[model samples]
Target: MPLALYLLAVAVFAMGTSEFMLAGLLPDIAAALDVSLGTAGLLTSAFAAGMVVGAPLMAALSRRWPARTCLLGFVLLFAGAHVVGALTASFAVLLITRITAALANAGFLAVALTVAATLVPTDRKGRAVAVLLSGTTVAMIAGVPAGAALGVLLGWRAPFWAIALLCLPAAVGVTKVVPNPAGDGPGQGRRPSLRSEFAQLTNPGLVLTMLVGALVNGASFATITYVAPVVISTAGMGELWVPIVLLLFGFGSFIGVAVAGRLSDRHPEAVIGVGGPLLLLGWVAMASVATEPAALVLSVFVQGALSFGVGSTLIARVLYQAAGAPTMGGSYATAALNIGAAGGPAIAAASLGAHAGALGPVWASSLLTAVAMVIALPSLRVIAPGAGEATR
Candidate 1:
């Protein structure tokens, strides 16, 4: 609840807007660049690839720098990339811009999480993280829709211009408000070596927690990526109502994170153990009620809440397990989440291809989330010795 934490959330809001807004702009981009929709879609893939590669690389590179410096540098780089992207018409140039932006995005998030974790006591870390991550839900609720409207009313490039402008204030906020934590100065305890950082992965609890993060995100995206089509074809909603459905999901996400933040502090195990099974049930409900408008709306809300609730706990779990390498731990979590976001859609698409229904993705999501919960349940023993007592 430090002002710096809110500033970090503002920074994250800009990054999340840029990342999610692209989905709504792809068609305009494809037409403008004279590329196929499939080719333009590669922009998203390129960004995800950059995130996977950049998180650890950038975190390692900036290990010796002050956390404030690293954050300021990444935010500036991110803003600059958006400016270039806004000016570009060529598909290849735009792709490069997205990749560059994503690298900076990854760096910003890893450092932000590290900073947030350090800003509070051990018990409050989960709430602090939730405050930072609420930016994503806010972006989904407001930014994406606004960007889509801007694209339709003005042009595809308009969203990029707005994103670039948004980043400037966030950059300034970080520069002006975020404190440089004491002892994070250059030449702080021997810089984290790549070997030691990678060694953290050897801890089975940390690795499993990271995997759970991936699976949680993957499951959510599997259904989310195709939600618009499902709403239209299955629920009989008009195309114009798609945004409303997404807004409901976003609202649920916001509430979920708010609840998870407090609950994670009091009962981390319940966040996973109880929330995970509910997420699976939510997906199953979605599949069962795909054609029922009222039922589907409720299902969407439940799915969103449970997905993010479980996700926030997975994040806190990884942070706990990877206490030895906090920065690297955050990077690993970011990488795992992006990997799931990228992979879940692909898997769902394949299932749809084979089964031919809106429910296909829902079923796929159910299976993935169920497996994630199973992986998470046993790992509670490894990550928290008091989890049993806490849950009871």
Candidate 2:
């Protein structure tokens, strides 16, 4: 709700848009750059791998700088990557640029979250991170669809150029608006030892929590990477309408993300418990789409809704696991998120492309989503019967 948060959100929206638009435009990008679709898919891999590598490394190193300066520098780096990516002609060049941008994005995302939490009261931590993160979800709703549309109209590179333009002022806005919350510099405060980071992570609850996050993300990407093509080939939709359908999928997510924080206050586990079923039903429905457009649309919407529905619970879930060590716990969650981001695409690609067998990506995602939910149930039970605020 703070203007500072909103500015950070703006930068997040642009970064997220650039990050995800590749999924919707994979075929176009491959053709433009003279590469295989699978090879182009590695574009996502490059970015995710960078995030996994950058999140903790940057978060740890930036401990010495004011959070405001760190954010501003990252945003400039963010904008610069897009500009470079937009201009590159060789495949290797584009790949390098994407990695650089993601490195910047990874640092910005983790640090902004750490800084934002300092701006709000403890009771509001979940809501604060949730709102800040929802900017990424909002991009899924509006930005990805819009970027896909632009790609269809202006070539795949155009969206990168647009992201560069969008990020330019967002960098300025963050420097001008976000308040500097005090941060314990590197090697200051009660810094968690390597032993502490390792020990806390070994806890079963936190481990399962992250595993579920990885599986869910893998489920979503494996199916979504091919969604546009599926609609075009299987559902007989027009090329012009692909992004519109994608938008419908994300519109459902946009609504779910907006409500998730408020719902967490009253019913966290109950909602988390139901996510797997919705994903299963969504795939079942998507399978029947050739004969049922309405059902297909509904399925995609439901998939978006429940996929994100459970996603909202992630930060709080981490807080619960950390128990007494909020800062360490928070860092663990961010790191897990990046780890998932890194691993999901490789797993999804293997499942969808080579071993997909008869049922294909939709069924694969559905099966995995169910597994994620089953695994998450026991982890959710670890939360104090009361809200997490006491220990969180």
Displacement of residue 328 (Cα, Å) in model 1 is: 1.3
lDDT for every model?
A: 0.83, 0.70
Candidate 1, residues 205-280, lDDT tens digits: the string is 8888888889988998888888987899989989987888898888898899999998886777778778888888
Candidate with best TM-score: 1
lDDT of 2 by residue, 1-392 (tens): 68887788889899889888888788987888899999998888898888877777776666667677878988998889888888887889889988998889888887777666656665555566667778887898789888988988999889988999998888889878876654453222445654565587777777787677667766766666667656676666677766666777677766666677666545666666665566666766676563455666677777777766666566556655654342345455566666655555455556555544323667667777778767776656753223554334
TM-score of each: 0.96, 0.86
Candidate 1 residue pairs that clash: none
Worst lDDT run of 10 residues, candidate 2, spans: 383-392
TM-score, candidate number 2? 0.86
